[model samples]
Target: MSSPEKDEIVVQGIAASQGIAYGQIFLFVRSEVEIPTYQVDPAKRIDEVARFDRALVMTRQQIARIKAEVEKNIGPEEAAIFDAHLMVLEDQALIGETIRAFESTGNNIETCFNLVSQRYIKAFSEIDDEYLRERAGDLRDVTQRVLQNLLGQTENALNRLADQRIVVSHEISPSDSATLDRSATLAIVTDSGSKTSHAVIVARSMKVPAVVGVRNLTQRVKSGDWAIVDGYDGIVILNPTESTLFRYGKVQERKKSFESRLLEANREPAITKDGVSVTLMANIEKADEVGIVKNFFAQGVGLFRTEFLFMNAARMPSEQEQFVAYKSAAAALAPQPVIIRTLDIGGDKPLSLQADLFPKEDNPFMGFRAIRFCLEHQDIFKDQLRAILMASAHGKVRIMYPMISGSEEMARANAVLAECMTELKQRGQPFDENIEVGAMIEIPSAAATIDLLAPDCAFFSIGTNDLIQYLLAIDRVNDRIAHLYEPTHPAVLRTLQHIVEEAHKHGIPVSVCGEMAGDPVFSPLLLGLGVDALSMSPAWIPSVKYLVRAMTMAEARALAAEALTLGSPKEIYARCDAFYRARVKMD
Candidate 1:
């Protein structure tokens, strides 16, 4: 996949993040493993079991250490994958099966353990689902660690990345990625991985530019080779020519210039030239990301995804654990409201504790997920509710529910929340009794019922990421149809206009907290539609603010008027692109 011009080779891959980086290539070559097999005496079978138990303890401790490191450097959601590895190590079925084999066959600990692990890995690999099949990678990861311990192999390849370079690797294990030096790593170019891999998720949360699934990426480049990672376009240039380097260097400088403008915009109000005001906020995954909110000068957290608490543990998080996390974020942004979205799990996000509860489905996106899962599992739902309520007393915290299809789902969710409040009241825990509750308008039915749903809630937050997907019946994550997921489609605009119109009618404010909210090109259109607020990743706040400060309500309204008259996404996109170029001078 590389170009014929060796010094100017261009390779394409999946764009895991958005940015540009230029640096020397630092190939992360992993050491190979060779497991040895030997026979054990019949009387020494018990000793083989002891050896296996020791390896398990060592691997668990190692994974915990890596988890803590990743949580500190990256975020808790990325670190949570290690919890699955720990679970695999502690699986009673796996360990018991291995012990039985060792005792019956008089085989060595390595042989018995490898045989049992392979069976489990093979079973998961055979699953038809992509997500379930990915679990096979986890099994292999844990088993490799145990085998490495039994083989006395303690070397690590990612320990010395203190020299700044773009990390080039064939395949990076999550455990190894945790050990990478953030200061030294400018970007990442991997030879193999999909968008769903945890390694890509880690790179994204760290704000590092990355391009994965670059076939033969490692084979074509050597250490110290000049590389340009066009993460915005998912291109990796190895041994880039002088002209190519010069071109990207200017692009990088322009990007820096735009970022400088965003920084300057931080001090400005998110107000239109015509004196219209719009609130700008951040969508955070963990409490630690509150620092980013403050740094970007976000008004508050519009969507604090509380699912991280459930995802980080092997089982349901205790009310106390959940309270501590929610309270920290809310308290950090005191006076400013932090709207915590509770338990948006199921579908893609399966809990390790309740994997058996949800079977495979043909269409998980439309299946039992989000609010549907919460209402069905009230115990898990209530525990999170109690925590959110308890945390509300510490600061201005609000509760929001995701994937609400209609008034019935919202009513059932409100019922469970009320029950939690009653239980908390009996326990005499102080909380904001008047904390506001909101609903996310993601599904078309929810948008259609905004009039009914809005009156019951204090506000509305449109989850445009999923709304656009569901509206178009396109899975944005599926690269095959990702091109069809258009945010600027006429139908999407009309739907958003409907929701906003309905919310304003009920005297409730509506905010967009999805990818559209962060994009500068769509900013004018959204403002024209009269959305009260926009919430996005913390990094987008400043740029969006800059764009917000430039336009007048009259101009934005005119743009929206024209955009609404358009028939196709292509036409709408062309208009927006022209408007953005004129506004930002990005090119």
Candidate 2:
């Protein structure tokens, strides 16, 4: 049953990420093949084993074909996620588990795969964290696809699907997304994801329309179906007719045109029409992302998360290797300030060196983590400082200490910095003595005591994600409290404005390196609040630049003043919304 000529069959959910896009619904259909539990002759075990191997080989080939076909039609960038999916197929974890279970239980591949998947799924289900719990989807996706290959039933519509604008799956496993006609598939949607999730990373790189965390998309959409995806707002509509498509399609085109116009704006200073020059920086986790700065033509790197280098590595990267990575990245993007935050791992990612850090804590979020761990474990702290010092010679590097609470913490940390510098100098290593140091205002205490800590640091980068979490005492990753994670919350805004104001009073440059900086909804408020710079992912550069170049400081400030008076988060957002709607020129 299709909707009327002008009507759209829209699917609604909590909009995770924001953007508008039009695409065909590329349903990522998956079926988990069960391991047969039928008793087989002990003598025929060899035959059964051979059968399983053949099935595995054939499935691999099918998946490979699907990947190749989709990539060829859609474009490699659009479909490259399947490569990650392909890796999962070969993962020893899933395949090995199935084999082990089959060997031990004397069950066929179907029963073994089910047994293994269910066990891992159960374990994942018990986890309280949404990020960890949702990992079950990936586990299930990978195990099922690989099992299907083993069962020789890999042929599916997604294998050779073709489209211009595609409505991607709830979560397009890297391998599954690879097979597509990108021109045909214009947008992507997923049921489960965070901004940092791999699928979104790939989508941003491809520069397509995407709405993540759209639940049950695969089940909601069908083959050869048309859908409207508000990639900017996380809205998906099934069976949107031509007229409905045209209305949104025009908006999509205008958004594209507006982003193109901002390419020049990136090169132009972020100074608003009223002469308020806000520093526009980029947030990056990988070395390759340095290119984003140049591509978006951003001013500098606001938040260079060094944890990625440390967390995903097999072992500690040698000092020389760290120097090379940092040097190459710095030299490549010379002149642009890069604020590297020391490893802020513990709750989301744990270090093997500090296994006992969280001792039976009820809330790891509030546990002995972040800077607390660094203070206790001076050895680890020293190594990271040494690495940063060694790399500073490459270019202008700013050090932003994470989780700092007060002046004493900064003093104690700086004292250790003095010691590390002494050791490095005695060892004949050259370092930057003039390299500026900054502090991440993530915790509420750090913000409250900004006057105490700001004196010691060269700069301040407010990490709003954590600040809001701590101030409200709500865990954003927990579904129950996740909705409360509002950047527009008056308390959150007040804290953000306070940090910027305090930093400016001390003559130190202040920037926002949090996710809020990237959001279009809150970007105006930040500028109005007197943010010196805003750093976010590079993909947001164009959309963000459009708003930045169009507004005057007077207008932004006026909007902010009214926004502050609102009681509800929704009300604050509405005032800001009304202001932008009336002011933003529709080209």
Off by over 4 Å in 1: 1-9, 12-49, 60-143, 154-156, 160-165, 181-186, 191-209, 213-226, 231-233
Q: Which residue pairs clash in candidate 1?
A: none
- lDDT per model, in order? 0.82, 0.70
TM-score of decoy 1: 0.83
Best by TM-score: 1
lDDT of 2 at 264: 59
Estimate, for each residue in 157-179, the C-alpha lDDT of model 1 and write its tens digit: 47577588899998777777777
Off by over 4 Å in 2: 1-7, 13-26, 33-157, 162-165, 183-186, 204-208, 217-221, 241-243, 351-360
Candidate 2 lDDT, 12-35, residue by residue in tens: 554544457655465665444545
lDDT of 2 at 499: 85
